[model samples]
Target: MLSPNSVYTSKKLGHYIVTILTIIAGSTVVATQINLGNRYRGFTITQLISSYNIFCSIILTSQFVCSVLELWSRFRTLNGQLLESLSCVGRPGLSQLLLGWRKRGNGEDLAARLRRLQHVHLVLQRAAELLQAHVSPAVTFHLMYSVVGIIYGSYELLVVSQAQNRAESMIISPSTSYSLCWLVHHLFDLVALTVSCSILEDEEMQASVLLRRAVGIEETVPQVEAFLRQIKRGPAICFTASGLLPIDRRLLVSAVSAATTYLIVLGQFGLR
Candidate 1:
């Protein structure tokens, strides 16, 4: 009786719901396992929590190293492409320079000046394009890895809470565990953002140096200084707005406070 499109839509919605439920069920099992492990092994919940973080840190570090290597490879590839493009325009060879100019300054032949200017412009434009392209994937990879690390950290936090049987220790509704998960997730994200921003800023400065060289400019310290200034200012403004501001700061703060409070309470009551 239903239209084909409607039937397809319903099926898709059903699959999505099923997927979500399955994830929830899987998480519940993991939490239960953590709780059982703590009980049977006679491990203090705090010890279990510490172990979880240690494990998560090891995993994140390995992934971070792999991501850095990948980023470096991409950066090298981008540099190679830019260099190849510059080579196509031909470098200022010794023979070309040996052809002495017949005139000086503004009196120089218009055609020659125009050619030099065109080459400069093309080099600058290509450098700009390459810089833009290089930044996009680096930012994307950082964000993707940060997000995954955040999720893993969140799961560890949730397991820690469950192991302690202090589910209500989270400030937000414990019924919506995902919200608490995200709060912890964002904390890890803040650290990742800072590290990634530093790496990107360094790469931008290097790219600027390469660009200046391509345009036949002497790569002076002042020019490098200016590039570093731009890198320091630009990405922070963009990344703060893009990454940090969107997170619920108040919720995160409250969750952290709650976590501390839970630790104190355990020390007083549970540990005693």
Candidate 2:
């Protein structure tokens, strides 16, 4: 049984983790961009444009992360509440059993509780829908950005590594360093996004398992029957990017595979 306090503590921890990671990523990108700019003389137009581009990208990425984190926190709270409700439904107090006017009265009490939990489940679904609606566009754009960035950045690194001998490549290229940093940053962001969604999906599964157990309790009610039906017939309890791309470990896997394939093709073209 998950306590509300524990859920709140976990949410605070997640906030700290996200904040620290965002700082590190943003700093690394800024540092690399500065290093690259130092190579050019007189703070030229090209350098100005490059700096502006990096700034904008960092800002947008940070905004997307913040949005996702907020939604993730809400989902965690609702998940915890659902679990708590389901657990209580499974176990009733001994006092309630002894003092009830009759078994029928006790059964009615349990049915009412189940009905309330059913309401909670409905609210949870609504929260999920709200989250999806608000973040789907941003998520879709982020996914596309990550795919393109990884493919191009990987290609650039490969070209640099190939063009220079080991010693020269190891010691001489700011561009190589920048590309490597950018790739790491993008990959980290993508992994974080996918992991967050995966965790929420796992929570949904946990709730379903608890609900199934609740079905076997001695005082089964129509609410329980309808609850099971709702679980089956309701919209899939999973996250998606614009209802087009499912955001999960599988998305991460497919993104990496596609990037690798494109990188290989680009390498072949460069060789030719």
For residues 148-225, could you state the per-residue lDDT of candidate 1 as single tens digits?
A: 545444544554555445544532223334444344444444444344434433543454455455334333334333
| TM-score of model number 2 | 0.73
Structural similarity to truth (TM-score) of each candidate: 0.30, 0.73
Worst 10 residues of 1 by lDDT: 99-108
Name the lDDT of candidate 1.
Answer: 0.41
Q: List the residue pairs that clash in candidate 2.
A: none
What lDDT does candidate 2 reach at residue 216?
64
lDDT tens digits, residue span 1-272, model 2: 23566557556756765675566466655756576557654456755565565565556555555545554555555555444444444346542242221222334355566566667667767777777787678778877787777777787688776755442333323366677777776786677778767866675565555556556653455666776777777775677888787888999999899989987887787644
